[model samples]
Target: MNDTFTEADLAPDPQEKRDRLLAVADRVAALVAVLAGGVYIGGMIALGAGAAPIVFSMLPRSIAGDVMGAIFARFDAVALGAALAVLAAEVTRMVAARRRGRTILSRLRRSCTLFMAVCAAYVALSLSPRINDLHRQGVQRDDTPQGQVLEAVHKRAELFGKIGMGMAFGLVVLSVFTIQPRRAEDEEDDDEAAAPLPPGPRDD
Candidate 1:
């Protein structure tokens, strides 16, 4: 084997690894934020539309009821999963941020947290009336009250969705700053951690 040596091959560079990892983390964080924002917006828009969602009837045995029931059962899970993703993405981004200075990410995190709360409220409000209806022995079938509650939920969903979009855009703004040349302290530590070794001989 030929004898050739370079600083890159000699030792494990922690800072380089950190830098690379940070870059990857930044990209992934941004992607997650964008997706979360889109989902939030879409969900909100649907909530705002006040349209009854239709599902294909599989069987004639109360097909509409079955589909509606299924949708209700699954809806919360879907929203919960989306909110969880945003929360997870925020946590991951926080971990990925290497150096000092809190930026728009903090605001984004707050926005995401609020968004999750809004989703939770939506789920809770949607179910409360149903639960109450079931509890009453001979309650009338009027769903006006339920509709009112649902409307309120829809409003929150739409508002939070817009807020999430703003926060996600803010994250993008902060990330742009991070990509620039780091401060001297940031540079100093990494550079000192892995100083160049003056001309060394190969000893494999």
Candidate 2:
């Protein structure tokens, strides 16, 4: 019997090829989302930690207030962009999984992504400007009812930013867990495909 093998014989099935392509795309998207989340969190940390010393020690109060405002505005812009990118990637992954009839995708991840995006938008568009305005007012009028209001706004914005960063980190952790299972499943499938079938008993 001829036992010659051709490239056609070794070629992957079309559906399997497509599935693998989609799996790779999903993995790439997840990685991007994680990276963006990291950027978002890192920027928040820098805004809180690095900017403070510069604002307080290196500059006068008026200049410091303006500098801090500009710094926060820029940080918010970058963080908002990163959050939106992560949200888009996560939504695309969810839609692709649903289209592929995959039941392994976690709904919690989607919820977290949505929440993070909303929080980021709110902070960037609304809270950031309000906080800057209050900072200016506090610098101008430090011992009045308006100053008390400034303190309140400061506390609220700080809490919201903290919550948003926490959500971003949570999404990263969830993505890691979700993708790990898929990686293991892919490896197991590859191993099974490579394993040889046992020989059947020969007929006499």
Please name the candidate that would achieve the greatest lDDT relative to the true structure: 2
Instruction: Give the Å error, residue 148, model 1.
Output: 7.3
Each prediction's number of clashing residue pairs: 0, 0
Error of 1 at 142 (Å): 5.0
- Candidate 2 segments exceeding 4 Å error: 1-6, 99-105, 134-141, 180-189, 192-204
TM agreement with the true structure for every prediction: 0.52, 0.78
In model 1, where is the ten-residue run with the lowest total lDDT? Answer: 132-141
What TM-score does candidate 1 reach? 0.52
Pairs of residues clashing in candidate 2: none
Backbone-clash count (model 1): 0
Q: Per-residue lDDT for 1-204 in model 1, tens only?
A: 856887768564798677667767766775775576566546545643432343333444235333444444455565566667667766676677644326555654556455564544455456533533432323222466755554454455446545644554454455444442444665776797699656779676
lDDT of 1 at 140: 27
**lDDT per residue, candidate 2, 133-201, as tens digits?**
777655433567876666666667778788888888888887776662454656876898899667998
